[model samples]
Target: MKLVKSQPWRNPDTVLAQLIQSCARTRNLDRGKQLHAHLVASGATPSTFVANHLISMYAKCGDLYHAIALFDRMPQRNLVTWTAMISSFSQNNKFGDALRTFSSMCAAGIKPTQFALSSAIQASAFFASLEFGKQMHCLSVKLGYDVELFVGSNLADMYSKCGSLVDACRVFDEMPDKDEVAWTAMIDGYTKNGSFEEAIVAFRDMLRGGTVVIDQHLLCSVLSACGGLKAGKLGRCLHSCVVKLGLESDTFIGNALVNMYAKAGDMESASSVVGMNSHGWNVVSCSSLIDGYVEMDQIEEASRAYISSRRQGIEPNEFTFSSMIKACASQAALEQGIQLHAQVMKTSFVRDLFVSSTLIDMYGKCGLLNSSIQVFDEIQHPSDISWNSIVGVFAQHGRGKEAVRALNRMISRGNKPNHITFVSLLMACSHAGLVEEGLEYFYSMNKTCDIEPREEHYACVIDMLGRAGRLEEAREFIAGMPFEPNAYGWCSLLGACRTHGEKELGELAAEKLMKLEPENSGIHILLSSIYASMGQWEDVKAVRKLMRDSRVKKLPGFSWVDVNNKTHMFGAEDWSHPQKEEIYEKLEELMVKIRKAGYVPFTGSMPCNLEESLKERLLHHHSERIAVAFALISMPATKPIIVKKNLRVCVDCHSAIKLISKVEGREIIVRDNARFHHFADGMCSCGDYW
Candidate 1:
């Protein structure tokens, strides 16, 4: 095979093609061009074989311009030539051009090969064009290539990307030989479509079939399914598989493992996975851990994870910021929220719609309505979520009129109010005692917005009526519902009955609730409170006994206030704070001052059989009172106290806080499970309705 200078090998076409392929593999465009020049200077007309290799070499080197130039000048094109050009176009993501070339090849009576068909199907997959993909499938069937391994895999992938998992499965089943490519496509498709159970089953089938080899990609898809189903055991098994295959060091595999463990609520395992891959700790892994902590209600851990990620030089993405902000909102941590807002301002994500919407929600939940409004105003073209955030902010602050105004503005701006928008709006009316307006919106759900009232909507209406002391009307509304009332509906009714002291109806509602949620401690507690309020000691005793027999324990109530980026929690008569003595002294002093200013204890909120003085004392030491006292002693005078409670604010504490606000000349914002109460100058934002 030696070449001579006087006479180059008689047929050097094969050698030239080999040299061109080597250049293509190395992506050496200059060397490939030199080879082309050498071929031209040798006084030889390049064969079709040599020319196709040159075209492919230019394409692999990312010189599509040269590739197309060579292609256009080819005198006689073969099937291999057309396939190479189509593959080059597809590989370069010139999908439209690739499809057009395929069509032109067919028009020129050049039948397609399996490689060409695969490339064409790939282009259709990118476009998610099911109709065009079906046409390609029909063509493959006509050419008797449908059962070819490569062609079948591409068709399956195309159908899956088009969201037609049914067709994908059909094509996959018809494949004579299922490879890893075909199996991965089917399993990944199931996961992406939220058919998590189907995905798990398919993975099991693939394993039991013992045909396709297990790989990181297949394991990643299965792990995602396990996460979606919260099947921690299955995820762990997949983790074992990943380790055995030595794929744990792979970046994608690492991220998938972290995400799977996070979704499974195994934060410790998620953290370990992150630690194992410290060098590859990316935003995806960090965000997943933070989001997991947030989901588990561990805001502190979530915050710490975010800080650690930043210290490790992992920049926070929009999702990381959103989850952290949501955690801040959940805890009413204003100082931390402010810090995060400043951080957001320095990043390009400040203009991100998702981040902006989350910022608005955080400010609103932190009792910074003005800041929420400002964030909303800053959005040039606010999305429906942003508008909903503003409306919800108004709703949280008991500004029903303002919420309605925001809704009107949203409509004027051509943003259609979705179910979430109306939920906030209805809750606003309920909190503000705008019962008639709430009913109007409820009716308009179907007539105007074409949204049928869901269970939550019906529950909101019942709450509105209940808040307005219209218990009978609330009951009638529940009865008139299209379906039987769910637990939420009955619970709303029962709470309203308790509020209005309708003991008989409260018992009926409690009965229904017990059947629906027999182990719910709140139902028993609310029913007992109803009996206690009516001075039915014997009935209260019976309800307590029933709770004991059923083993339903009441969840303890606690309130937390954030000051200087630190959260201080308080329970009833809490003595756990480092400055508990000062907090108690401040509480006594405030109680005295409010009493002198005509603040009388509302002992009715106690709901217990006790002496009047004891009831009053117990009422005075509620968690919110202790938290407020701590805030008053610890925070600066200029700063408003924002408290978050795990339960509803009782009437006695509400009244005392109102008088305390007047006595101390301080604004107190308290967020309970139900709504926000802005206590200032002896008045609450709910107008004494909630």
Candidate 2:
């Protein structure tokens, strides 16, 4: 539709402005310019409104230069033109330019409107520049924009994002009236910044005042923060809110409910939330269920959920791949992971960083390092996740030197390492007994990189120092921690104490461990063993009585191996297999042959239990013992035997495996919670560090 020109008016300025409006309404900047030229040629005085619209057209059409040029040429301008320029700069992410524009606008003797001030505040929020945001807030009130709801919301959000929730509340309360957006901004500010309790408080106030309705977005925000906390009471209370609102079947809320319950360790609640749905498995809901199952280590359940997700016609995204790959890694299900890899290749997300990195991690953990490396190389630009995954794979393989090489390569390529990168490096150093390297990296993590060390980082350092027999240093380090020592930190020291035969320190560390895990009998047993090793047999008897009295038993150790398309499982002293007799016969013969080749029994392992002779028998039928025997029978000689253990392999087993490695001239790789020990040619990669 063509814009009809307004009739010539008694006010020539008004007639020129009308013609300008007609040109602006046409959205033809060229025509507006031509009309402006005609007005200038006709010597008609320009009105502020005409100039403002001309500025708006320049700003709106992504022509900030023309906008600024027009504003400079105008004899008179209003706050609208200034607001338009500032907002345009911000919308283009020219934040510095926006700030400069605001400064210039102020210098031009025009007080900014709330629209301009709010736009500047939002830019501050994006950069987390609260000082600037605060200045804007002060100006807002001085300029009479503080009472505006949108302005207040922007200021509150900026304050909250800068970790100043108190000021955010001050601005929020200053508003005489608030809209849903204001309420959502305040609530989201708290929730996004991890202030869940405060969010709940504000939400409750909103409910009581009837200020706003809790929508699905608000519920998801609160529920995400609720996931890390064990708040079954609060979770159930939130469930009641959902029920009252009749939002139980809402896809997003249902997904959030699943995550909240799953993290609270209420699997029944989590399962019920997902089970109630027949075919409402949208991408968000499907991913949440998959995450819940993986977090619980129900790999098979996660797989079934993945299948159901595909059936529901919601295509999987990066998060879905992350969850499913983690499931296969935890289960060590290589075949299923391979199938998933094929599917990942077919998806449009094949090159996505998250999807590819998880795939690398899964394949690496599955002992397919070549596959992991291939995927890593295929990445156009690897993220820290990709680098960390490859490095972790090397560390897990007892390839500390290779891991360090990989890390160095990443750094050489200008890829900065994060906490995960440092973790993999520290782990590699610990496994390879590179004490000095671990120390250097630990110090560099904070001093050079400025990555504030978390408890896990400190725990790795403690474990490294302890494994290196620097017990005093480890104790001092723990004492110097800014935060209280956690279970992992103390547990690492405890493991070191046990390793280095520091019975006194071992007892002290056990005390800490016992406090952290009150019902844990393993720490008590380790303390008893340390005492008995030092000839305090009475204390050993006392610990035995305590364990029996507490009715706490040691966790059974199990091992599984795959060969000839069949999986074999072994438990400690397990003679349940039909071929047990034959297995024992072969073991007896191999032991005799190995002993003839200078192998001897290491009995220091037996005193953890009461009977010395029975302990020897138990060691003879231990899981690793059974696993090695099965390897000899099932696989050919000269092939390396890899065994993954649930816990650290015992000292006696370590020595026995070394003897076997030399006697049979075979390589055996044993992976446990602490590190990997590769026995080859009578040497273990740990170098007796274990």
Candidate 3:
């Protein structure tokens, strides 16, 4: 593999030029060094022309040290030499060096060409230096190079990177000719700024004009824009283009296709793309599938996908692990979450910002607050997300004062509180019956933190006041909002009304909520509960009949318990368990003990009017009771029982569980849709506020 010295000498310059080109293309560092030796032995001083090519050759081969040394030794410097050096710095991710080199070139009284200016603009964009980018733009305008295709595209991208989408669009509009590069830059800018509609418009213009060829990269960006907008029709159009261009085998496009379909909620298409061998499924494709499944609330399916990913050699990356952890949190799978944490600790992603934050959330949702606190304490420098997660966990567990203290510490560390931080703080105050503190924080949202309150913030305020039994004040606050309250606001008031036994306000809130969210069958149940509380059996029957007429079916209440590393699910009056008879017998014995301890079942909890005996029987067989019965019989008395419920615990069950916890001398942790309830010694951790 050695180069011959005695070669044709008729055209020595052309031969050396060809050799350098060949070396640059093939990245043959050895042959490139040999060519340098031949140049030195020929006794011909390297001209500016030959030196420029040598610098470019070394730079393209990824040998930046040699490229810089050769450039410094050159007796002469030209525009191409400066451009190549700047590009070399940029390609190596040394953006600061690239900018410094450009300054040096300017000090030498050299005029920059279009390519040199473009490289400097790109460096500014990478650093997101808005002022520096403006200076470069002014210089380009003064030099009459701003209109050039290469410089124009770089300027557009630079503005976008600085988060100035308006300026980016203005620069794009000023360009005389629109090329594929220009279109791609504009599309990327809109997508990055969350202007999905504008991005779609620009892409449509590109297709109608037909002046520029749509390359795979341009199409990829547009597909992402479509996904953001959930424009599945447009995505299918792009998919067709991908097939027509025969770019289906391209790995990057294949991943984008899967992501687009997943985000659009077209799971069938996304799964099909992954299943096709021609699409070249990789780690990203599988990760997208997992995320999509989580978004669809298919936690079990997401877990199966994670297992399948591990069976293959494709190791899960940060995004993969984070998505899987979220799935576990949603399912309340504590054992699986602990296993995943062990796997994460073996990799560097355990310390990653997103993975660490997600781990805290997963542990908190699993009723493992100690583990959550440990994860939070171990973070060397927590970001806003980490702070929010810790504060939220404390709030969710009914530790309101602790959450407030954590927020104070977060601010003391020089981290500014955002809207999400305020939300967590407000929710904490609400759950702990701190109505005054919650109101103070809600009012301070705009004045102190410069954060305008959104609908969610207003909803939190309504919930806090309502939970405190201030029903009239809550209604007045809703009436005084800048805009009509959303469904969440009305639903919060409805929940509060139900809690405080205000049938009139509850019915009004239910009317508004029904108008906004007619398909929400949970609203009907809440209204029925309100009527049942007032002894209006006919009104409850009417509500039930309306539901039946409309075919509105409520989600059945389900509970899950993990024992011996296996999760068991139970539905209302479920008798499918292998030890159903034993569970019932144990429940009967517990009922006797609870009755002797002054436990009386609240028959009003039943929405339907039935015989007193029938209502009591139905209340005895609720899903949570069945799950608790199984846990009490299966596990040791010293161990605490944790049950996860899909719906809120009814008043009858909540009352029964409290007495049972005291009778059996066991701690029971129940996590419903909204928050955690810890029952011990005949008292609930929520303080009966929820």
Tens-digit per-residue lDDT, 63-116, candidate 1? 999899989988989999999999999989999999999999999999998989
Q: Which runs of model 1 end up more than 4 angstroms from their true locations?
A: 1-11, 26-178, 277-280, 380-391, 401-422, 440-452, 482-484, 514-520, 554-556, 575-600, 658-667, 673-689
Which of the two, 1 or 2, has more lDDT?
A: 1
Candidate 2 regions with alpha-carbon error over 4 angstroms: 1-147, 151-176, 205-210, 398-421, 452-454, 472-485, 562-567, 585-599, 608-616, 631-644, 655-687
Which candidate achieves the best TM-score against the true structure?
A: 3
Report the lDDT tens digits of candidate 3 across residue range 1-690.
123255654366666777887898999988998898889898988777778788888888889898899888888888888988999888888789888999999999888888889989999999899999999999999999997889999999999999999889888999999899999999989998999999999988988998889788898889889889888888998999999998888877888888899899888898888877644457898999899899888887788777877887679999999999998888767778888899999999989989999999988877777889999999999988999999988877767798889988988997788888888888888878888988887887799778999888898889888888999999899889998778877888898898788989899999998889888888999899889878899999999999899888988999988888778889989999999999999999989999998899888647887899989988999899999999999987876688989988877888889889999998888888766777788877665655
Clashing pairs in 3: none
Worst 10-residue lDDT window for candidate 2 reads: 1-10
Q: For candidate 3, which ten residues in a row score worst on lDDT?
A: 1-10
Q: Cα lDDT of all candidates, in order? A: 0.88, 0.78, 0.86
Backbone clashes (count) for model 3: 0
| Model 3: lDDT of residue 73 | 89
Give the alpha carbon lDDT tens digit for every residue of 150-183 in model 2. 8999988889888898999899998998877788
State in Å the error of residue 295, model 2.
1.3
